[model samples]
Target chain A: MVIKMNPYIEYGKKAFAKNLVYRSDYIIGVFNTVIMVFIQVAIWRAIYGSNTQINGVPFSYVATSFVLSICFAAALTANDFVLADKVLYGSITTELLKPISINLCIMADTIGNNLFKLIMQFAPAVIISGLFLGLLPPASVLMLLLCVFSLIFGFLIVYYISYIIQACSFWFTNVWSLSVIKNSVISILSGTLIPLWFLPDWLAAAIKWTPFDVIYFAPIQIYLGQMNTQEIIFTFAKQIVWVLLFAVLGMFIYKKGIKKLCIAGG
Target chain B: MRKLFEPFSFYFQHSKMLTKTRMQYKLDAFLCCIAVFVRESAGIVGVFLVLQTFNNIGGWNMQELFFLFSIIFLTYSFLVFLFSGIRDFSNIVNNGEFDKYLLRPRSVLLQIISANSDYFAAIGHGTLGLVLFIISANSIGTDWSFANILYLIITIIGGVLIQASIWLLFSCSSFFLIKTDSLKDFLYWNTRKFAGYPLSVFPGFIQKLLMFVIPFAFVNYFPAQYFLHKPDLAN
Candidate 1:
């Protein structure tokens, strides 16, 4: 039997290819990410001066976690600005009439764009940090494979969160600051700026229950061998559950948003 | 005197109109303020987490670091509030609205900067910074002498000037590229992320780069150090 491919993945590929045309634009983006990562690593290094551990995780592990978190964030924060614009200016009307589901198309395109960014921006960043600043290697081959899957889950979690923010444009009409709030909250809660281990115990535990930790913290934990096999599976299960939940929530929001837009003649 | 007064009066008038427009969309304006506040608070939380982990980064404790962070944060909030038009310069230039500013009788720079003063977002960020400032000051037992106050005021104004010039330089590139928003975002926004931390945590070369090339060191690092009476490390 022949296998049928998802058409939305084709949109992802087209979106990926679209970015290749502007590959030059991302050179500075990679450079900026590298510099930012370097600055972060340096701060962590200073914090760990003459010391080996930060809240049970070694300094090196924490640095590696930061590297992964920063790169993942750079790669996965897909273009909500464009989505917001489409909603704001009534261009979403035509977008809704597309052959495939609008949300699927947008997510596919975002995934493609983020895939390109992962290769261009995130790959170089990891390489630079690995060479110069000492990014830690994945624990084992199995952990490496699991880490990659977790990163995909992480991306989906972020994508859903961003989708909700974009969908807010229907209700709020001018939800630009909502994006800023979303990003900042993600950066903190997802362990982009600081590892979950460093957060206050109660706060860390609280964040673990949210989808934010599944985005960066869980993968970083797996990469650092902080989680056992069963723990890794459980973490992955949690991420998958969050992804499904957010995906459903996103679709519901989109449906209601579209209805509101139609009724309001936006 | 009249020439100088004209710009201030124009800014005041434009700001009033902008505030009124913002009030028209009361819910959005309120939500935007809360959003900005949340973003700023998250940055503080990041700082709090890091300092909690390390106890002190370089020679600076959490209170001292918060002071440094607040200075940059408050100044940035002020810049965003007063000169939001400059931040949106690329949009204006790209959409041909810049031609309108150019055609105005007033100073083109003044007219451009006064176009969209984002008072609500500014207040949100600024209030966060002010709150942090008060917290840090109280925690550190900061000397509230007249001299210290004068120095703090001057240094803060200088920091604001540095930030404004950075924005102006990057935004001015829109004239040549006509699509400089991405570049501006990269340069202006990304670089500012490093401002909250102590410069001493960075390598010597990065320290030199921040001090000389970008002048971000002046934004908070050097000023906070001087304000706190720490020995100069730049020299």
Candidate 2:
């Protein structure tokens, strides 16, 4: 019996194998994640000194938020230049000639890389840091499952947004500044740098209108049981809407960018 | 004196050429500066929001915290301006470009140091640091006497040297390891992040790590204490 293999899966495996070559990154990544978590937790501890609860939120919630957010940030390692590099280095022609979808290939590569990170870096760092710094138990098993479900959508939202930015390279030729700006905006507005609770009410409300919060904070809230059944459903729906929105936007840009693509060298 | 100054002249000539090449893409350069400024400003905004929520962290208020961050930013900008080559040494080694330096008549270290600089990062970070320094220095009410100003200058110079030496040490490791990026990120960047906050905010071991292991405490925290005179630093 003959078997057919998926090209996208092969691309994913290739990406996964590529990361294996950097063995030391796996080790240092754990320490990096731990130290980053520690720094934020220490700062938060100093902020909450001598106070068990501030504004009806306990200290453990903030600690858990940092631990989860940093871990997710570390694991959600989508390379912002994956598509841009191809376009810049004149490799996009070859990528386009391939029968497989370039977008799917990029998505597979990202998923593969993140899968390695999740198992190799994220699990260990989460376990180690969660032990050193206490973590609140998940709202429940059902909530934990739903949080993971929502997190997948969060990853898609981030990935599609990055794709849209990378697509700009056809016009600009260098998207580094745009990527930096995107990362800064995301980190600040998404509650990755500071919990949204601490943000002024106006700023927090402004953030809600954007898709940034669904990336990290929404999953966190679901895990912490901060959301009720209705709220959880609403949040998940919002996440799906963002993923679809960004995906459509990314496709539009990629189409226009490809139409105008220019390669100077053979 | 001419013999002694030869390398300095060479460095200036090399840097001048590099700056000219960088300026060819003026818009990219300007955008990069703004990108870095915005990136760094996010952290400051985070701190500001935190302080707004909680009036003070470990007895260091907003202005004092901004002053502490400004010191690190200014010193780091200088370090990047002078020693970005060392900061990116692993790439040079991995790409087999280090041999070109060895072939030169001048010192390998001098070639490495003078070969490249990141003026964009320097400008971006320097602008932020200067703005924060001006605002915080005015509000924090530092006497800014001759001695105090001189002390600040000395402290900045010391910080640049301390941080540059740390980068040099890691860059040297690239000769053997061939990839010290993650190691540098762990030892240098992560510790630098910790240094942004007051040393008293961390645990005892972290404080010790900052003081003895990396000495980043001296980079910003101790100098900040000299000016702010926080109660925690009395010991």
Candidate 3:
């Protein structure tokens, strides 16, 4: 008998090659996002001017947050989402019949997709924000490493959450609307559109316990040295917990949804 | 004698489609209204918070500034609702979808404008932007001269044209290049920022770039300054 390797490594390489071809578009995407940051900052600057404060955040902080928000949104972009699309199009039936565990395949596709975004969207947004807005203060190596690890976990959580939404298409074709609603809420709660600090108090408080913040907000803040060690530790812990929670939920939903899938041959 | 009814009938036919689209998802339509209600109301609240921090910006008191903000949002919301499909032009062109538009009997611009009319979300935030503008303007105690009102309309309509033109330009490029998702995102972010605030804060060079190159000032700032009586803004 001959042993075969997982197809994920091949899939990831193909994704990277695809990204290389469309690289200009990705750069422009980051550039436009930076432009948005400028516009947002300009608006807030017009609003704040010389004011000292609003809702407990300094005017400068608000301006800074405006810039950071764009960066974080870019960093967490979930570009690759083959599992959900595969599942919807009945491609997953073929994929599932393979010897590789369904979980590993999903993880591979997501990691490959997100890794491209991580560099193209996330890195550039940070560099641009730092250059125009303010430099992110340096932090301890330990804190930085923890932030990266936590962010990886957070990305997985985001993938799982998105997959769960995609899974709903197993039952309904009109998942786009629900997905839009989910995206808007997640973008807000994840501190992508606006930081949790600037949001309405209730909205901010409602999602505090979730891992969404840990994904973008926590890591970036850690990079900027905004959070103290204990806070960093606590946030990363929360993030890991949510990743576990979502992963479990994803497995359950996929199992249930697989039964509902109507393959033409079967 | 028979050629006169095109644009008018176009608008009417638009209203008919708008009504049906609104009816298609009654619950969604209602929820969208709620979302816009909450979002715009929060914006108004944010505007108010900013006002509290300052007595007047560039000699426009809070009420007048709010009036300006409202007008800007109103123009933006309207265009985004109606002309937003043009923003996707780049992608359409890239995919050779524009070939279909060129083949259509209707005017290309008209078809494009009507192509992706998000009537629900458009009406949602659009109505909100309009009401807020009216409330803010009325509260400001400015007597609207007939000429000033005409200028206000021109500024907004012209501003919409300017923004829509930019979108159209980008969309057309998609005929030359297919993946416009990146450009579309960039344009939206840039537009949202421009729409959200007055243009005076930036340095002269930056302002010139936005005014002459982008001409975004036509949307709200110049018009607002006219009513607010900013010293340097042109007629």
CA-lDDT, candidates in order? 0.81, 0.90, 0.67
Which candidate achieves the best TM-score against the true structure?
A: 2
Give the runs in model 1 whose Cα sits over 4 Å from its true position.
Answer: A1-7, A81-83, A262-266, B1-4, B232-235
List clashing residue pairs in candidate 2.
none
Q: Which regions of candidate 2 deviate over 4 angstroms?
A: A1-5
DockQ of each model vs. true complex: 0.71, 0.82, 0.25
Q: By summed lDDT, which 10 consecutive residues of candidate 1 chain A come out lowest?
A: A257-266
Per-residue accuracy of model 2 over B4-76 as CA lDDT, tens digit each: 9999998999899889998998989999999989988889988888877789988888999999999999998
The per-prediction i-RMS, to one decimal, reads 1.7, 1.0, 4.7
Tens-digit lDDT string for candidate 1 (A193-234): 887778887887798678888888788888778788789888
For lDDT, candidate 1 versus 3, the one ahead is: 1
lDDT of 3 by residue, A1-28 (tens): 7535457787666666677787778778
Cα displacement (angstroms), candidate 3, residue B43, comes to 6.6
Which number leads on DockQ?
Answer: 2
Which 10-residue span in candidate 2 chain A carries the lowest summed lDDT? Answer: A1-10
lDDT of 1 by residue, B205-225 (tens): 887877887788888887787
Quote the lDDT for A48 in model 2. 90
